[model samples]
Target: LADDGSRLWLNYDLIKDAKQRESYAPFTKFIAVASDNQTLKIATEELQTGLLGLLGKKIVTVKTATTSGGIILNVNKNAPSSANISNEGYEIYTEKGNIIISSKSETGVLYGAFELLRAIQTGKSLAKLSITSSPKVKIRMLNHWDNANGTVERGYAGSSMWKWNELPHRVDPRYVLYARANASIGINATSINNVNASSRFLTAEYLEKIKAVADVLRPYGIKVFISVNFRSPRTLGGLKTSDPLDPEVRKWWNDKTKEIHQYIPDFGGYLVKANSEGEPGPQDYGRTHADGANMLAEAMRPFSGIVIWRAFVYNADPNGDRFKEGYAQFKPLDGTFDPKVIVQVKNGPIDFMPREPFHPMFGAFPKTTLGMEFQITQEYLGQSTHLTYLAPMFKECLDTDTYAKGQGSTVAKVIDGSLYNAQYSLMAGVANTGSDVNWCGHPFNQSNWYAFGRLAWDHTLSSEQIASEWIRMTLTQAKPTEQKISDMMLKSHPIYVSYTYPLGTSHMMGESHHYGPEPWLAKSARPDWTSVYYHRADSVGLGFDRTGKLSNALQLYSPEVQQKWGNPEQCPLDYLLWFHHVPWSKKLSTGRSLWDELCERYYDGVVQVGNLQKTWESLKADVDPEIFENVKGRLKIQEKEALWWRDACVLYFGEYSKMPIPKPLTPPQ
Candidate 1:
């Protein structure tokens, strides 16, 4: 993964262009800077490394630095002067024949410096450049969900990156490496433990270990948070009750937070998954989600820390669809949460499936803050083997019109606080990183991490634009190859959904691991965990009818939303089955019956995989063999799985549809 993803997008290779390099080269002849701080030292060293590689000539330190027609990295006098830069923001301007990369902080200068180098690599002319930007969201963070046992929850790769046994004393190189990777993508905050947390982390021993990692990440402008076990006071602190409003409980949290700050003053905060997923919560003591969040918020407020309360609640309810549970649970608590508490909602009502309708909470809660929680690890998608680019998946949800305020209530606007008029907003990605040599196991999986950061920074950036920039920076700067890969990436999510679960039919993946198709699986004791519970597939047709008659899940949305999605014709094609149950013979707008449409989609997925492989092959000349072969290999796996999906679905649904295979899609059997 490009040196195990240690360098990420900070790779500063020499310019492949003749003219731009010549223009930038003359400015590199002399270097003079007015500062001698450690951050400035890092900035200078970064320039040397990037310039040396890009220019193919090492730059000797000039006794004095100036902007007299030379590349200058100038920091504004009033810029944020500390170890932290806003984690990710920078400005680059080129005028008067001099390129000046400046920011309010040293790390900003570092980011700007790298951005300038990237512009050069992409062959963008540098004669005139002016840019100023910061992250669109206040918190562009990654939730590790990594356990102290070295195993990660929902981790597809081998194991977690944290080496708990040898921490605080022996800092592993992976700690620094992981920090660098996160910083490269502008991720500033990391919760170092699983949200389904254990109480062992609160021990002084483990806090010391986290402190070491925090120290390493400090310079990179990354802060560390912990997923505190809700029952920590009772389970570990020898307390009788864990009630949030209890004075003793409040005192316990205050002492705990202060102790944490003592070790790591810049600690991000706590992420609570209370009363959710069997984890102990305030509900156990008859307190509400807001009460639980506010309790933690009170503990963190003194330190300016924010508590990220997860809205991913679901019980083993036998009577109700799990999709409706989250909105039902949190919708009543609007305007109830403390300002320091941000509700973290998953991208989908269910889990992180390949394609999901936007969560209902986006435009619903106008009074309280909410955060988008995306799974970078492909839990429902094909883990590391599939070449599914998730940027498009993110875009589909972010770009959807929630229409809470009539229109233009985009999910992006909702999370950015503009729609809700809230004070703070957040975005979190369930991290996919691990101990694999390539970090994410599959080379292409890194794109999911990269895409999450790009979207977190600016949800306005189109998925295509993000993909294009990613391909150029991560693979090669060639336009043709970048466009080709971007095209493949753009079509990846839909193609996967078409082959895997089309027409909004979902929860059909293989039981347990959710690796492959198992649409017809029977129910376990917990209805929510079963595929049959979600799809409701039968002889009449496939899909859940959430209209007034059947599931009636549509009631959660606004009347306009109910009117739009309440009908099959008006509902988006992606969500057609999520709300309706049409006959197999029902004609889609494509002039094909539901059966034929399904067959077409299955075959279309197969064809798209071939097209994607061809697209990747077209870039072999420009992409390095190390990275090219990695993605090529994964694309082959995707091709095989696409066929598996097509075969399994056609075989299973052919029984219900009772339609002969189309001439173009004749099965081998």
Candidate 2:
């Protein structure tokens, strides 16, 4: 059978190496279940299926391990003193001539089962296996931007995967496969609708459809969350006002939440996007963001649910640094939210740019639990067409030293609740999945989804390590092929950034669709919507100036951050344009004028895209024919688009710098 990407990284192709298979066949004698629960049953079945595919063996399930050289799923009611793991954590090791997958909860056993399968799939030596793993963030989730109309906002793949028109009674088997994929990656929570929510989802009719989804996901240890409309009381319940302070509105939400719980007992929680980009919120009724979130939190208090309030809000003032707005609005309200409320801040202050400095809110809101929201969809990158691996981008922000609690404080620590010892920690990815056979449009795009879940589970894993594992499991297992593809995957993001957002120039993509380059864009519906508003390109220089002279955005970060990024000479070149407005002729640390360096990066970026094409073509012998052709075609488009970006940006900015495209850097014919 041809390799269609529908299976994702869970592909269980039989082990071709006889010696490698012999090593794993010992554990296939039987899979013993310590406890028989719904989740444990799923774990047992998955292990059986994986063993059958990988070892060509039929494994039997037993109540307990009566013999040796088998796998045991042990759930310790009172966890062993030496086992340091959360309720959803697992400690897998070889013990008593049996490999034990021990956990405090059944879901942990399920995760461990997948981990064991992954080790085999990735050709890891399990001879002396001793692995202990847990999710770093309490809630690692995927936030879908799908609508009830079956269209996804900013979605570049196919139509929405929900099939909302056929639900409640006619559940699609795809939901089961989806749940299995998410469970394999340790994503325990998912919101089924767009954060720009529809009030219809709150209606009884749509609740039935959502309940159907929750049912399919529940057994896999995945919980369902809803992106709720703030004004649902007025829009759906015919209330006079949906004000958070209004008793009638409060009662309506309480009743609605209770009704939802009746249909789906484990409904995870609510995700809200309010008072920004035309979304209605508490501000419409003279209430702060806290008031709106707390009201929802109060309704969820009776249930074991949460309220994830988005902090992506910003004013339309072109003069205001939108970078500082999220901090300005929520920083003062720190330590003021209900225990159930978690502020979900985007990875960057602005929208998901090609390259962005870490959001200032990371360390600023020390009193609150802040969840990281990363866009796995390539809205500002190249959408589904370009092969851009986002793991590096995610790692860039995570590994960044926020200096929140001194030098070693990273964004990873902040969102994992270790920095200030917050109660909850979350990391959500805006999903890129759709109705495409591959789920994501491009075959390689699956890596972004895989990378997000893995990092959310353990932020310490390096991007290269994740890429290597993904390549071995999903693509070719050939060592030479894997190394070559990993190199291209690691470099893909920087290459895209080089042509599009080098030196932190951002919001330059075509205005509405957000594809291709448009740095010359000077007008849009809103002043802040225009590329010129962000790029500030002129005869003097290019890039935004967030210094106090223009906007006091730097004050939002710790003094360490401010001091580091304040001086033009001291700032890293990657983030230089984000904070400084240097003269076009000013020589950078690279020993070249700003214009020259900019031109070099743009020109070289196109050349690198050509190199990516060459790399993929060389792997044609090692990869699936269908997948190779698919990637080859996309790389062709990428190179053409890279040229489009290079010429357009270089020429447009050259109009201001009055500089040539530098020697040895000529535009494509």
Candidate 3:
């Protein structure tokens, strides 16, 4: 009952308002469920638990829908289907004074049950509830960058949630809680390890451990997927070469796939990160990406499994633009991939920066099933220290007009199979979850996870709406508090971006850890890894010239997209620096010189963090003391880091520009 954030958004704490409780009590008189499936059982139990907590009364469970004026869960064979609603979709309507949840499958009933509980927790009117909903994408998944040794790669929320040391014998209750949290938000599949995978996970020893985790998640309609090291044949089975064309290598993977199925029959196949960041792949054997992916796809095809091959591959080419690497590598292999293989591409062409144009690969691959991969973890967006609700960022990418099919071809349509008519569709988020007591480290960080799941379920949902729903369910039902929190969540991303990488000047953070500002870093193991490689700051100007002159990266996009972002004078100010290198004294559309504008943005960004701190301080009396203080402390750290970023970048860049900081702007201390 303590507000340690361990409950996440499933916090079905008793409603303190008397009138609200009275209003919900009528529907909690009795619960009737007709299905006997494990999923339905969990649904029934969840509804019962939620009703008891919210309405302060225990509801009786009935075998039939004989009892009226209570919640009824039934699987209807004919449910008046629509294009928007699939077999997994549910219809919840109030029929004859009884709330009826009708669906074609038991999984639909479970999702409906969670939706009903969400409506209650958010204090929505259940009197005339008529909601028919289905997921926009087929496979909504979470990619955890957690290693087997309990150390997460880009993870900031303590250690890995899947404790490898305590496996099949000791099942942690936390694992079940994690499933419940993900299930509540309609997340169906999860890749349990980092894409930079370990070969040990393929062995019999680790299969048992994975099976234990899968058993806990199965009841919640969530399947476990593993990130497989491509050279598992050589590393684990002692093969001479892990070539896709080699019969011995193919047989090794076939046996391994069969062995994996033996432990967990419903395992969602492998997520591979090959030939990127030093990962071994088919390229090492003079084969294409399709060769590597098809080999795994064929092995998993018999079992109805899929191979999610990551398209985040890039070379250490000093002259090559990192933004163009993915498009160049994957464009030719558009139709070459097997039917079961879905190419997982990051939302941005480069790594997950604070801001980026939508990846050109989104609409380019007309024949391939292109899945959108978003990083829910704050890898480049200030990690867990800064409070950045990424729904707005995610929506920006999803809503961008790729112009692939002339007028209104958005990225969402492409991934949802509406644009390209692909056979399979998936949207994955690099998970921010860990072994932290609060799940995500920061209290506000929980909102990013909630937002990712909500947006993945329905890309059309607005960021403000998602933020409001999360605030009401997790923090407070108070209207004023809800509005304040929602406003903060909406503005946090832009504010963080302003101080750090304003106007699309990305990858300015520290080289290795990617922590603070380091625009001066010119040397690293690889050219693309350094900050100077991206900013391209010289005595004349700053920003990478990705237009026609330098890399011609903009040429990869459709002509319509190129026309929109090509011109420096007409381009959106937010993306100005991303495409063109402007002189320090050149005037922008904002009527200020480039140097003055940059300084103002950096200084103003720090001020915005101060404003956020003030807004949060006003909620001290309204929020839970523990959670409130946790966020309060993080805001202080955010302010300090925001200042650190402002000072580091402005001073460093100013050194190259030879321009004085504008007098109106407060110079960094």
lDDT of 1 by residue, 91-143 (tens): 77765666677777777776676566666656666667887767778788999
Q: Count the backbone clashes (under 3 Å) in each candidate.
A: 6, 0, 0
The TM-score, computed over Cα atoms with residue i paired to residue i, of candidate 3 is 0.98
Q: Residue 428 lDDT in model 1?
A: 96
| lDDT score, candidate 3, position 42 | 92
State how far residue 501 of model 2 sits from its true place (Å).
0.8
What do the candidate models score in CA lDDT, each in turn? 0.80, 0.91, 0.91
Q: Model 3: per-residue lDDT, tens digit, 1-669?
A: 449999999888888899998897667777888758898899999998888777778888888867568999888868677786888889899987789988888888889999999999999989999999998988999999999899999998999999899998899999988998888888999999999999988989999999999999998989999999999999999999999999999999999999999999998999999999999999999999999999999899779779999999888988989999999999999999999999999999999999999999989999899999999999998788899999999999999999999878999999988898888899999999999999899988899899988988899999998998899889998999989988888999999999999887989788789898888888899998988889888888888899999998999899999999999888898888889998888899989998899989999999999989999999999999999889999999999999899999999998988999898785433
Model 2, span 1-669: residue lDDT tens: 779899898878787888989988776688999667999999999999888887888899999888898999988868765535788999889987788998888899999999999999999977789998878899999999999999999888899999999998899888988999999989999999999999989889999999999988998888999999998999889999999999999999999999999988988999999998999999999999999999999999989999999999999887788888898899889999998999999999999998898999998887889999999988988998998999999999999999989998999999999999889999999999999999999999999999999999999999999999899889867789999999999999999999888987889889799999998888888888988888888899987888888887888888999999988898988888988887899999998899999998998899889889988888888898889999999999998999899999999999999988778774543
Candidate 2: where is the Cα deviation over 4 Å? 80-83, 666-669
- What TM-score do all the candidates reach, one by one? 0.94, 0.98, 0.98
